[model samples]
Structure formats: C-alpha cells, structure tokens
Target chain A: DQQVKQNSPSLSVQEGRISILNCDYTNSMFDYFLWYKKYPAEGPTFLISISSIKDKNEDGRFTVFLNKSAKHLSLHIVPSQPGDSAVYFCAASLSYNTDKLIFGTGTRLQVFP
Target chain B: DVKVTQSSRYLVKRTGEKVFLECVQDMDHENMFWYRQDPGLGLRLIYFSYDVKMKEKGDIPEGYSVSREKKERFSLILESASTNQTSMYLCASSSVTRVSYEQYFGPGTRLTVT
Candidate 1:
C-alpha cells in the first residue's frame, strides 16, 4: 500500500507565475514531511520541509504547507523560474528523527518562459 | 558538504549473474540506505544500515542483501539477478544529528538485467 501519494504526475507553469504541487498521505502518524527536487540524471536535493507541529514553512521562493487534519501537504513556488523545472518528491517520516521515509511517486514540474 | 558516490552510473548484467552495487559516503553518517526507483513506484527501500556491521531490512528486501563493514561504505548484493530486478538504484546517507532528517543521495546506478 502506498502511504504517500502525489496525484498529479506532471504540472506546467509559466515563468513568474506560481506553481503548486500537492501530496497526500494515508498514514497519520507521519510527523515530518520533506520535499526534494531532482534534475535529470542527478540525485535529489532537499528543498523544503515542514514539521507536523507547524502548518507552514518557507525557504526563499519555496513554501510548504501542511494540513494535518486532511493528511495533505502542498509545495508552492512563487515567481517560478525555468531552473525550478524538475521532478519533486514529497517524503514523510513518523517523526523528526526517523530514518525511514515514505516517498510519493513524484510530480514533474515544468516552469516555462 | 555531504557526498554520496555510487560505484557505477550504468551497468548491464546477464540473468543469474551476481551483481554488486557499492556506495560510499564521506560525511561519517550513521545511516545508509539502498533504494530502487521504478517508473511509478517512486523509491522503495531495499535495506538500511545504521552502523558498522549492522543492517536492517526495509520494505523490499527479498532479493537483496547488504553489508556495511566500515562506516563509509555500504554494499548491495544481488545473489542471482533476474529481469524484474532491473531498475535505477540509489544510495543515501544521513547524519544522526536529526537536522530535518535530510538525506544526501548519490547520482544513482541504472542496472539492466538481460
């Protein structure tokens, strides 16, 4: 069973516009959520993360919002740039210190000019 | 910066052959993980090692075994490879400091079983 799911397989947004990627998880025990960005043929790098204690976390142009009651989270990138185009994976862990993470299928975000 | 390196970027092996995928991390991390990525399956963990000579099975560890003789190295062994085992293998390592629990990943190894 997939504990984490990214319903959208792909997303496209024009440059300078906002891009939103959504993720849902079936396990409510997950307390820490992270987003990673992966480029072609490269390893995924950490983008942003949110703890269950907080509803939102932001890093520069990226912001991650979590809704614990709904078991859903979203990543928002304002003024999206072409460099932001990549596969984004949302991962969840039972706690902030847990080593095991359940990852979503991923959403490919394309930021165009 | 944390650096994770895999042995090969792409590998081709025949069925029933023994395949070994090696990974090394330079950050002296306490955790190392091996995962396989498929088209729609995302990344499925095969095994993880928390310390030297210590290992634990992950969600999908049936066809694989792992060894961590040293703190910097982790090895994944495929006893007898099969066609279904072909996929992109990734290695990751994270420190025990619990700083957002971020994992540093390798470039990945694309293994093809023929």
Candidate 2:
C-alpha cells in the first residue's frame, strides 16, 4: 500500500497566480513532512518542511499547511514564476531523526507566463 | 554545504552482468541511502546504512546488496543485472544531527539493463 500519495500527476498555473499542490498520507505515525523540488536530470532539492506540532510553516513565497487530523497537507506557492516549474514531491517521516522517509509519487507543476 | 556524489551519471549494462554503483558524501554523515526512481513509483529505497559495516534493507532489497566500508563511501551492488532493474538510481546522505533530517541527494545515475 502507498502510505503517501499525490493524486494529481500534474498541474498548470498562470504566472503570478497561486499554485496549490496537495498530498495525503495514510500513516498516522508520521510526524515530519517535507517538500522537495526536482528538475529534469537533476537531483531533488529540499524546499520546505513542517513538523506535526505546527499546523503551518511558511517561507518567502512558499507555504506548507498540515492538517494532521485530516491526514492531509498542501503546498502553496504564491506569485508562481516560470522558474517554479518542476516536479514536487511530498515526504513523511515518523520522527525528526528517522532515517527512512516515505515519499509521494510527486506532482509536476508547470507555471506559464 | 553537504554534497553527495555518484560514480556515474549514466550507465548501460547487459543482463547477468554484475553492476556496481558508488556514492560518496562530503559531509560526515552517519546515514546513507540508495533509492531507485521510476515512473509513477516515486522513490523506492533499495538499501541504507547508518554506520560503517552496518546495512539495513529498505522497502526493496531483493537482488541488491550494499557495502559501507568507510563512513563517507557507500556502494550498491547488483548480483545479476536484470532488464526490470533499468531505472534512475539516486544516492542520498544525511547527518544524524538533532532537528535536521534533510537528505542531500546526488545528481543520480540512469542505469539501463538490456
């Protein structure tokens, strides 16, 4: 069974608009969530992460909201730029020091002008 | 900055051949992981090591083995290459520091088995 899932395979958004990507996980034991962005032929880079203790965490233009009760989390990118186009993956771990991370299938985001 | 480097960016091998993929981390990380990325499968862990000479099986470990003779170098070995094993292999390493679980990934190696 897939513990973490990204139902949408892809998403398209207009530049300067808000882009929302959703992730759902079945494992309730997960306490740490993270998002990573990947470009073609490149390795995934860390984007943002939120601990289960908090409901939300925000960076400059990116925000990750976690609804632990709903077993869902969403990543919001405001003022999406063309440079933001890439594959996004959401991952979950049991704790902060867990070595294993369960990752979602990933959502490909395309921001157009 | 933490840097993970893979031995090859691309490799092609024939069936039944023994294949080896190497990974090295610049930072003194205690944990290292090897994952294979396939279409619609995200990243599946093949193997991982938390210390020198200690290895653990991940979600998938069949037909694969790992070696961690040193703290910074980890090797993934395929006993016999199979066509189904063709995929992109990614290497990652993370420190055992508190409050930090971010894993640094290498460029990845695209392996093809024919």
Candidate 3:
C-alpha cells in the first residue's frame, strides 16, 4: 500500500508566479514531512520540511503547510523561477528517530519563462 | 557536503546472471540504504544497514540480498537477475543530525536485465 501519495503527476507555472504541489498520506503515524527537489540526473536535494505540531513552515520563497486532520501537506513557491523546474518528491516518517522515510511518486514541476 | 557514490551509472545483465551493485558514502554516516525507483512506484527500500556488519530487510527484499562489511560501504546483490529487476537503483546515507533527518542520495544506477 502507498502510505504517501502525490496526486498530481505534473504541474506548470510561469516565472514570477506561484507554484503549489500537494501530497496526501494514509498513515497518521507520520509526524514529519519533507520536500525534496530533484534534477534530471542528480540526486534529490532537500528543500523544506514541517513537523506535525505546526500548521505552516516557511523558508524563503518555499512554504509548507500541513493539516493533520486531512493528512495532507502542500509546498508553495512564490515568485517561482525558471530554475525551480524539477521533480518534487514528498516524503514522510513516523518520527525523527525512525530514520527510514516513505516517499511519494513525485510531481514534475515546470516553471516557464 | 555529504557524498554518496554508486559503483556504476548504468549496467546491463542477462537473466540467471549474478549482479552486484556497490555503494559508498564519505560522510561517516551510521545509516545506509538501498532503494529501487520505477516510473509510478516511487522509491522502494530494498535494504538498509545502521552499522557495520548489521543489516535489515526493507519493504521489498525479495530476490535480493545486501552486505555491510564496512561502515562506509554497502552492497546490493542479485543472486539470479531477472528482467523484472531492471530499474533505477539508488543509495543513500544519513547521520544522526539534530536539525535534519534527511538522507543524502547518490546519482543512481540504471540497471537493465535482458
């Protein structure tokens, strides 16, 4: 069973606009959520993360909103740049000490000029 | 910066052949993992080791085995390669950092079983 799911397979946005990516999970045990951005051939790099206690976390142009009741989270990028084009993956873990993470299928984001 | 390196970028093998995929991490991390990525399947963990000479099977360990003879290196072994095993393999390592619990990944190895 897929504990975490990224319903959108792909998304498109114009430069200087906003981009939103959504993710859902079936396991309520997951308390930590992370978003990773991946280029074509390189490994995924960490972008931002949020804990279950907070409803929203912001880092520069990236913001992650978590809703425990809905078991859903979203990544929002303001003033999206062309360089932001890449595959975005959402991952979750039961806790920090657990170490192992369950990742979503990934959403390909394309920022156009 | 944490660096995770895989033995090969691309590999091809035939059915019934034995295949070995190696991974090495330079950050002196205590945790290492091996995962397979497919189009719609995302990343599925095959095995993981928390320390030298220790290993644990992940969600999908069928037809595969792993070894962690050293803390810096982990190996994934396919005893009898099958076409179904063709996919992108990734290696990752992580430390016990207080701020982040994220794992660093390698460039990935694309294996094709013919």
Interface RMSD for candidates 1 onward, in order: 0.7, 0.6, 1.0
Task: Indicate which candidate wins on lDDT.
Answer: 2
Work out the TM-score per prediction.
0.97, 0.98, 0.96
**Between the candidate structures 2 and 3, which one is better when assessed by lDDT?**
2
Q: Number of clashes in model 2?
A: 0
lDDT of 1 by residue, A21-110 (tens): 999999978999999998877888989999899999999999999999999999999989999999999999986439888899999999
DockQ of each: 0.80, 0.80, 0.72
DockQ of 3: 0.72
Clashing pairs in 3: none
Model 1, residue B6: what's the lDDT? Answer: 99
User: On a 0 to 1 TM-score scale, where does candidate 3 land against the true structure?
Assistant: 0.96
* Model 2 regions more than 4 Å off: none
Docking class of 2: high
Clashes of each: 0, 0, 0
Worst 10 residues of 3 chain B by lDDT: B94-103
The true-versus-predicted C-alpha distance at residue B76 of model 3, in Å, is: 0.8
Error of 2 at A106 (Å): 0.5
In candidate 2, the residue pairs with backbone N, CA or C atoms under 3 Å apart (3 or more residues apart, or in different chains) clash, namely none
Task: Kindly provide the TM-score of model 2 when superposed on the true structure, using C-alpha atoms.
Answer: 0.98
lDDT of 2 by residue, A1-113 (tens): 99999999999999999999999999889999999999988889999999999999999999999999999999999989999999999999985438888999999999999
Task: Give the alpha carbon lDDT tens digit for every residue of B1-114 in model 3.
Answer: 679999999999999999999999999999999999888788899999999999998999999999999999999999999999999999999986646678899999999999
